[model samples]
Every structure is written in structure tokens, then in C-alpha cells.
Target: MIDVYLFSGFLGSGKTTLLKHMIGQVKAQGLKPAVFMNELGQTNFDSDSVDDGVPLKELLDGCICCSGSEKSEAQIQTLLAEETFDVLMIETTGAAHPVEALDAIFSPLFAERLNFKGIITVADSKRWLSRDELSPQIRSLFLEQIRHADLILANKMDLLTEGEQAKTIFELQSLNPAAQIIQTVHSKVPFKQLEKTTAKKSDDVVKAPVAKLNLDTRVLRFEAGVKRERFEEWLRTLPDTVYRIKGYVPLEGDKYPHAFQYAYGMAQWLPEYMKMQPQIVVIGEGLEGVELP
Candidate 1:
């Protein structure tokens, strides 16, 4: 049976960083790894991160837990039929509930071929500390992500002070004491150690009480190149409800479009060598009819 691992976390919690590390480690060990990624927007910006040779399947425009579950099963079925790999790594959307994602994977058709490894959750230490600032629904989702993991990585430890770090670990431990919690800067952890961990088995998997979040996404296409300064100014005008933004932007005078990411009021721009589609996907609450500059 092939090993299957689920990577769960909130928006901007470093799941992709951990995924890259795992892919490298798996390759180094002479093992093949396949990736299944789910995105909230029609365009998947993170799909570029996966290597060209790796087998990749993406479910876009929905979360696997709800509207995307059927699509997810079909994608997995296609992957199994088309690819030969030792392990399959599934990276769910940030808003996904871990239990629901697992349920989607436990399909009868492919159940015998997969050895369910476990859920590895990446929690932003700073986000947990300030979770109260979020809406009750979002906060509950964040906690549920932590509560269901077999192994939890308290990521972004560098951003927390000594006391805050203590509290972050303490609070996470209080929520799920059975899981091993590790402090990581960029979701870094020992791959060999993770391989030895198995998920806790229970006869009954309680469904999470929280309903699906009323989150929505907006895709912004740039018809003309814009000044970098002006783009940053527009980012500042975004309200706090905008949880995550990622895509490529064509900045004036640059040879290639730059990859842009925004989360928790911070924006990052990375220069790209190849020109990509000049569009940005904004994910947040009540984003319908929202205007972008």
C-alpha cells in the first residue's frame, strides 16, 4: 500500500514550505512523491512550486471538505491510475477541516491501496496568539485544524517572543495533548521522525461542529503594468477581512512579472524569471463585488 499524508493548516501557516522540504527528502531517499493540491481560486498560483516531473493534480475553486470532495476523489482516482509513486501528499486548502478532508480520502474504491499515515498541521505561532482578533467562525476553524492533527508544527517561531512562544505551545498542547508539537521557523522538521509517526485511530471520528466558512475569492487581472509603489499602496487599503492574496503582478519596467503574496497585513513580492499570467487571487470573507486597484 502507498503511504498517504495530509498537510493541514490555516492560511499562510507554512504548509507549502513543509511540503517542499518533504518532497526533497522523499526524492533524496529514492522514493517517488505525488502531490494533490486544492485551491480556493480558479487559478492555482502554488502549482508552480511543484517540480515539473512530479505527478501533480489540483482541485481549484473549492475546498475539499465541501464542494470539492467529489472532484477530489476523482482526482485521486486519476492519479492512482496514471502514476506510480511510493507516497501521495495531499495539501488541503487553508479553510479546510481536517476530519472532512480525511473522510473525502477514505473512498471505498481506493481504500485498499492507501495506508493513511496521518495529518500534519502547521500552526502559525503568532496567529494562535492573536486568534481572538478573528471572527468566531475563523477562530473555531483554526482550533479545529490543531485539534485533529497527529503531529503539529508551531511554525514561525521566530516571530514570537519567549513568553509568547511558551504560551503558543501551551495553548496548542491544551487543545491536543496527544500530538507531538515541534517549534519550527519555516515548518522545518525531521522527515525521518515524521515517517515513524502514525495517526491515532478511533472507532468514531466526530464531525466538527463548525459550519463551512462563508469565505469567497476574487481574481484580479492586471491589463496594464502598474508601478510597484502604487501596488503597495493599494495593498495597504485592503481591509483586515482579506485573509490571503497570491498571484503574479506585472510591474512596470520589470523584465518579468513578480510573484506576490499577502497574508495577515503583510505583503511580499518575489521577482520571477519567467513571465506568468498577470492575475491576483484574493481570498477572504464577504468578498463579492469587492473592487481592486
Candidate 2:
């Protein structure tokens, strides 16, 4: 049976970055890995970020919540059947519910071949502290992610001071004392400690009610660089209904275009300086009619 670790967190909580770190550790430990990404809507960061050697499978139709368990599990089934590996890492969207996704893996087809090591929920320290300002919908998801995890990895600890980091760990431990709270920046940590969860926590997680967040999800697939300034303006001119965005953009004539990623009201600029055409992705709420140059 292949050991499986479910990496769960809300958008911008650094789920993708953590995957990179975990895979590197797996390689160092001489373990081969197969990764499955449910990169729904407009995100384009998964494929390019991984090395050429590790096999990858993607399910990009929509959020896992919308896809349901059976279909999502089928994608995992397909990937496992196609390639054999020593371990599997599932990086779920920050918006997705981890328990629901984990439960899907319970299907008989996958259960026999897989052993769930533990669920690792990577928490966003600074942002989570300021979650009250966020929409109730986003806040609820983050809390549920923490509530359901068997192990909680508080990433981006570098963003905080020594005192703040201590407080954050204390607060996190108070949130779920049963969970092993490991802190690090960019999800860098020794895997031997992170992957083990022999604690006897109860099976039930107290779920906070989720509000009807007007999720403005879209698929932005564009190949253009209509002046970075113009595109930035286009991004700002979008409707208030737009909540989040993620995708890749091949800058005109530039090796790899720019990648647009937004989470919890924060945006990041990921420029690809390599000599590859930017075939990227973009997903947001109010970007229905917006087009890239």
C-alpha cells in the first residue's frame, strides 16, 4: 500500500509551496512519489512547478466540493493505475473541505492500495489572525480545515517574530491540542516528524457553519502580454464580485508569461524568466468578461 498524506489549507495558505518541500524530502528519503492535483478552474501553477521526473495527475474541472467524491476518487484511481510509486501527496485547494476529500479516498477501489498516513493542514499565521475582516465563507473553510486535520503544520512562521510565533503555536495547540503543531517557513521541515500521527484524537470535528460566499470562479486561459500596466489596470477594473483569481499568463514575447495568483485579498507576482511560452490559468469571481491582452 502506498502511503498517502493529504495536504489541506485555504487559498494562499501555501499548499502548493508545502507540496514542493514535502516532495523534496520524499526524494531525499529515497521514496518515489506520485502527486495528484485538483487544480480546478483557472489555476496553472501545479504542472510547471514540479520537476519532470515525478509523475503528475490533475483534475481541473472545478472545486472538489462541486465534483463530488466518486468522480474525484476516479481521477486518483486513474493516476494510481497509470504509475506506481512509493507514496502519494494530495494537495487540495484552500477552499476545499479536507474531510470530504479524505472520505472520498475511502472508496473500495482506492482504500485497499492506500494507507492514509495523516492529514496535514498548513495554517496561514498572519492571515488567519486577521480572518475576522475576511468574508464569513472564507473564514469558515480555514477553521474547518484546522478542525479536521490529524496534524497541523503552521507554515510561514518566518513572517512572525519570536514572541508572535510562540503565541501562534500556543493558540494553535489550544485550538486542537491533539494535533502536532510544527512551524516553518515555506513548509520546510523534517518529514519524519511531520508525517507521524499516532495520537488518539476523536473522529468528530466541530464544524463551523459556512456562509453562502458568492464564489466568483472562472477559467482564464489567455496568451497575451498587452502591456503589464494595461493588464494590471484591467485587473483592478474588475467587478467587486470578483473574490479570488489564480492562473498563468505568457507575457508577450517574454519567455514565460506572468502568473496571477490571489488569496485572502493578497496577490503575488510569479514571473517565469525561462524560455517557455506562457500557457497559464486565471480564476476569479468578477472576471467573467475580462480578457487578457
What's the TM-score of every candidate structure? 0.96, 0.83
Which residue ranges in model 2 land beyond 4 Å of their true spot?
Answer: 198-213, 221-223, 226-244, 250-253, 264-293
Candidate 2 lDDT (Cα, 0 to 1): 0.71
What lDDT is reached at residue 22 by model 2?
A: 77
| RMSD (Å) per prediction | 1.3, 3.2
> Taking the tens digit of each residue's C-alpha lDDT, what string does model 2 give over 107-197?
7877898878878888988776676766667677778888777888888788788988888889888877878888878777777875576
Query: Over the stretch 25-67, how does candidate 1's per-residue lDDT look in tens digits?
Result: 9999999999999998889998888987999999998889988
Clashes of each: 0, 12
